[model samples]
Target: MLIAYARSLVYQEQAVRKALLELQNPRRKRAFGGTLTLGEFSLAPHLKTFFQGHPDVDFSLKIDNTKEVMSLLEEGILDFCLVEGLFPKEGYDVVLLKEVPFVLLVSPGHPLAKERKVSLEELFAYPLILREEGSGSRDIVEKALAERGYDIHGFQKIIEIGNISLMKRLTEEALGISFMYEDAARKELAENTLVQVAVKNLHLTREFNFVMMKNHLEKDEILGYAKEFQGFFAKEAGRF
Candidate 1:
């Protein structure tokens, strides 16, 4: 089917455009500027490197829930999105950046912090603080709960938080408990401000993805760069 599409006369003009974009003479300038958007917090260090490595690129990153990032991608408002968990492959190019575990977060003062193990149902008994509606963390946790015949909304007490920094602060204050990617709370865990308590009945892991609309990579040179970026991340996936 791809071959048939490639052979179609309808794409002849687009192919010519791609060829022109790949021509050496077209790249007269050495600098470019663009925006970077992401859903996962773990990408912070790598994102810093990505920007630092390309000083002339002048890129800025926006952090939000995966759903909103994908929305911006669909609207052509983002160059690409670094996402967490499953994303549709249709009409887009996807690169799996990494896979990491998500764990329960509790303030040092919370009862569960001292407990050896807590079940999913027992977690629902506490004041649960969750990421906003479109967040990847919220999505992953809800799906996991659904598989066990539970739901985030079914929890006894709930608090919805939009910002991760604020959520961590709230948790540190013993306002509520949350589940997040383990690396996201590493500093707090190390400082003893937050603790990781195993959810005895559940263990959740999610994937990080780099996604861009296929049309956005229309130029052969652009596609080459995107693939190169994919290889770079894949090589360092385990470290992230």
Candidate 2:
């Protein structure tokens, strides 16, 4: 987190001051750059277009799971963050930038691959792959199950993995089944390497939130950029 904080502050020097001055005058070219934290890799393609239009603005982009993004934002280490899944609203204010659906991911060879949908009870019979403790996907899934009167630990052979790439690789190898955003699994799905499974009665959905300090909303300098950041996703969010 400290490394992320330092890297983000690099744009805080002359560039930022000059940018802020330019922001005051409409006729001047605007220049502002800082750091941004991202919880979902799916947002990268959209952000690429945004950066192309703002050449003068330099930003440090950090990729982390939704769990860590919330902690960093709450500690004020990040000016703003985009995350998958829901976060607590106590210390942070959030805009619903988008709503994305998740699907069950399994190897093509898995018996359930040909099935349109499977019950949650049948999924419990297999070895389940889950994200690490701080993952937003894991949190939401667990919460959903708990609400259904299911014990989280009741799933057989629950394996915890931290790296998304590695997790996908393991799932492709038919080690276990996992859940992820459909967008993230696009390539695998296209190539027929991974098959998406739908849950019979469950809808796996989450939000892509633009989150920041609630109090900062009333401040000008931060608010302007924060709202601008939120708008980027808000406009494109309709595609989801």
State which candidate has the highest lDDT.
2
**lDDT (Cα) of model 1:** 0.66
Model 1 TM-score is: 0.76
Question: Where's the lowest-lDDT run of ten residues in candidate 2?
Answer: 30-39
lDDT of each: 0.66, 0.68
Per-model TM-score versus the true fold? 0.76, 0.75
Model 2 agreement with the true structure over 30-83: per-residue lDDT tens digits: 222221113335566566766675666555566677766665655444556767
Question: What TM-score would candidate 2 get against the native?
Answer: 0.75
Error of 1 at 136 (Å): 1.5
Q: Which residue segments of model 1 deviate by more than 4 Å?
A: 1-40, 218-240
What is the per-residue lDDT of model 1 for residues 126-168, given as tens digits with 9 covering 90 to 100?
7889887767778778888889898877777889987777888
**On a 0 to 100 scale, what is the lDDT of residue 121 in model 1?**
76
Which parts of model 2 have CA positions greater than 4 angstroms off? 1-40, 217-240
